[model samples]
Target: MIRMPAEWETHAATWVAWPHNRMDWPGKFAAIPFVFAEIIRHLGRRERVEILVRDAAMEARARGVLDRAGALSANVRFHALPTDRIWLRDSGCCFVRDGDALGAVQWRFNAWAKYDNFQQDAEVAGFMARAAGARGRRAGMVLEGGSIDVNGRGTLLTTEECLLSKVQERNPGLGREGYEKAFAEHLGIRKVIWLGDGIRGDDTHGHVDDLSRFVGERTVVTVVEPRRDDPNHAPLAENLRRLRAATDQDGRPLEVVELPLPGPLTYRGIRLPASYGNFYIANGLVLVPVFNDPNDRVALDLLASLFPDREIVGIYSGDFIWGFGAMHCMTQQQPALAVGE
Candidate 1:
């Protein structure tokens, strides 16, 4: 049976595309590369960092920045490939393990169904699969990794706003049943915990990664807005209620933890999607996105406690979020396979 591994599980490598499409970051493009380099520096020492570059020139540029930051290391590898944006989590392959065999689920990426320049982004999965010598299979459904969180034990977390709603509908005729079947066949998901809407000002409509996540098989940490007057208060509160009543694939109660939202971060009058829930879990470290908010310490402390054995490091993302994503959005983990596989 093919099963998707949990984020906290051991990783073979982390895939990230070098930021080249400056249009995504608008006025804040120059600083985006430095942010990615900083993230790579932390991840390179832990596991392989597979970086995608559009061409040789782009790779050299990336190398210069990484070298300047003292991040160029033996653990970092580059692949020349075309890309439209830097959000690899949604565009990249979802690796699975079936016995001793490694596989890649090449889901159809439509740029969250919100953009028109995803032609190159859609091919990322297949390319990654070929590079890793994995058995590649194209999923029938158009799904993004950011839209769902799996426990690696058959349970999954997603949102109705991103999947079911007509606004930016991913699959035209596929309903909850269709999605659950796809999850079961591909990711080995048996139970699905459907949450409500996502955080406000999130471009991907309601990706669950920005709202809730599975920290463990029976543990989930979700974002909550304490201010009832805020627009995100009602939706986040409802999602928390669902999590409290939710169960895992084996019908056990889930231990729900609350993570506060980094108070509204705005750039050019637009509110960026800044949440402690967007943190990325690596092999030996957890990279969290901090927005210079008062809750930065609170979020870091809570995640540190949750991942006691793993080092927790916060990356300042005040400029990165302006591109409509953070650390988790930019990285996709490749689960390590069994020895001798």
Candidate 2:
């Protein structure tokens, strides 16, 4: 049987692609590399960090940032892999463990159905599967890593807006049942919990990572907006309602905890997706995104209670979110090969 492990499980390494596309971040490319380095600093301390670079020149520049941040390069491996964008979570390979060996599901990516320059990003999963020495299976579904979250057990979390909606529709005719069938066959997920929608300003339709995330086996930390005037209030509240009534693969009630959304972060008038739900869970740390909002500490404190065994660290992602993603969007974890692989 194949299973997608939870983020808290031990990882062989965390994968990150170097940000070299200035068009994605616009005028803020200068600071994005440093943010990646700071994230590598925390992740390198816990597990091996594999850095993907387009070329030697890019590797040298990434090394400079890692050096300045005092990140240990011994375990930081660099790959000469070129990518169109830095959102590797959506483009990278999704790992599944079968017994002791790790396998990968190469989910097709259409650049979130919003861009035509996604040809390079579409083939990333095949490359990643080769790098991990794992057998790869094609999912044949237009899916992104940010669109789904799993409990490493049998339950998978996603959103209706991302996989099933007509607006920014992916896999044109693939409704909930079709998508769920594909997930079960490819990732061995027995249950899928679908939420309403994502936060406003999300370019990937509605990625669940920006709205809801599974923090434990049967517990989730979802974002909520209190003000009715805000655009995100109704959608988040509706998702919270769905989560409260949802159950896992075993029919157990889910313990849903509400995470606060950071204040609306805008650049020139465009509101970037700046929610705290995009945090990444590593071996011994949870890397959260903060937009300099007053609720940054509150979000961190709440996560600390849920992840008491691990250190909870916040990374400033105001400039990075201009591309509309954060720490979780930039990284993907490869679970450690279990015993007897």
Candidate 3:
């Protein structure tokens, strides 16, 4: 059985793309590589940090940044894998383990149905399969890692606004049932729990990683906004309701934990898609995206209790959010494979 492990599970390595595209980060491009270095520094302590750079020159540039952050460790490696953009979570390969063997699930990537230059990004999974020496299984559907969250067991969490939207139609003619069946066939999921929509200003429509995430097999930390006047107030409330009512594969209600949203963060009057929910779970640490909002400590405290075993570290992502995403959007985990089936 092919199974995608939970983020909290042991990882052989965490893969991320080094930020080089000025267009992706706009005026804040100069500072984004430091954030990547900070992230690598955190992940390298526990596991390998595999970074994809466009070329040798970009690798040199990344090395300078990592060196400055004191993150130039042996576990942090660089790969000359070019890409159209830096959001590797949506464009990178998702590895699944089948007994003792590991393979890559190469889902179709179309720049989230909103960009024109995604050919290079679309080819990343094949490159990843070759690099990791993992077998590749190409799916006939379009899916982004950020659009789905999973528990290693058998259940998944996703949003309707992302998978079934007409505006950003990922896989045309594929409905809820079609997607549910595909999840089972590709990722070994048995239950698909769907939420209504995502928070506003999300470029990828409604990626679940920006709204909710599974902390364990039965517990989830979903983002909620209490201020009724906030744009995310109603949509997040509805998602929470759906989650509380949903059950796992064995028919048990899910444990829904609330993570308060950091008050609205806007850059140049544009509401950046900033969320405490966009946190990455590493082997011994959880890298959370923190804005300058007062809720940064609050979000970290709540997560510390939920993930008692792992150290919770907050990365200042105020500049990184100018790219419309945070640390989680830039990474994909390769679960550790066991020896002998």
Candidate 4:
């Protein structure tokens, strides 16, 4: 049986693309490359970092930045690949394992159905699968990696806002049954935990990575906006309520840990989705996005307690979130095969 491993599981490598589309970041594009370098530095020390660059010049530029930042390491490898954006969590492949075999679910990505320039991003999963030398399967439906979080066991967490809503309309004719069947077949999921709407400024309609994430097989850390006046308060409250009432695959109650939001972070009069729930778990580290808010300490301490064995590093994401994504959105983990394990 194929099983999609959890983010906290051992990873052979982490996939990330160099930020190129200045339009995504607007005027704040210059600092973006350095932010990526910092992320690569931390990840390269823990596990191999597979970086995707546009071409030779882009790769050289990335290397210069990495070298200058003292993040250039032996574990870092670069691949010349074209990409429209840096959010690999949606464009990259979702890897699975069955015994000693590794597989890649190449789900269709259409820039979250919000942008017109996603043809290159659509081919990313196939390239990722071939690069990892895993058996690749093209999913029959459109699904983003950030839309669903699996627990390596049999349970999966997702949001109805992302997959079901008519706003983005990822799959028109497909409904819950079609999605569940696809989940069962592609990722070996037996239980699907559906949450409500996402945060206010989420560009992908309502990606669950910004709202909730599975920290363990039966444990999840979901964001809770406590202030009643805030736009996110209602939806986040409803999601928290659902989590408290939900159960896992075997009907056991889930241990839902509440993570506080970074308050209302905005850039150029636009609200950004600055969430601690968007943290990425790598081999020996947990990279969390910090908005330089007061609650950064609270979120860090909570995640540290949850991941006692792993080092939790908070990256200043004040500018990164302006692009509507953070650490987790930019990174995708490749689970280790049997031999690597």
Query: Candidate 2 lDDT, tens digit per residue, 98-147?
Result: 65678998998889989999888887889989998988988777889999
The TM-scores, one per candidate, come to 0.99, 0.98, 0.98, 0.98
Q: What is the lDDT of residue 297 in candidate 4?
A: 100
- Candidate 4 collision pairs: none
Q: Write the per-residue lDDT of candidate 1 for residues 73-185, one digit (tens) a residue.
A: 99999999999998988999899986688899999999888899999998899999999888998896799999999999999999999999999999998999999999999
Off by over 4 Å in 2: none
Each model's RMSD to truth, in Å? 0.9, 1.1, 0.9, 1.1
In angstroms, give how far residue 171 of model 4 lies from its true place: 0.6
lDDT of each: 0.93, 0.90, 0.91, 0.93
Q: Which lDDT tens digits does candidate 3 get at residues 154-227?
A: 99999999999998899999999999998998899999999999988799999999999999999999999999
Candidate 3, residue 323: Cα displacement in angstroms equals 0.5
Better of 1 and 2 by lDDT: 1
Off by over 4 Å in 4: 339-341
Model 1 ranges off by over 4 Å: none
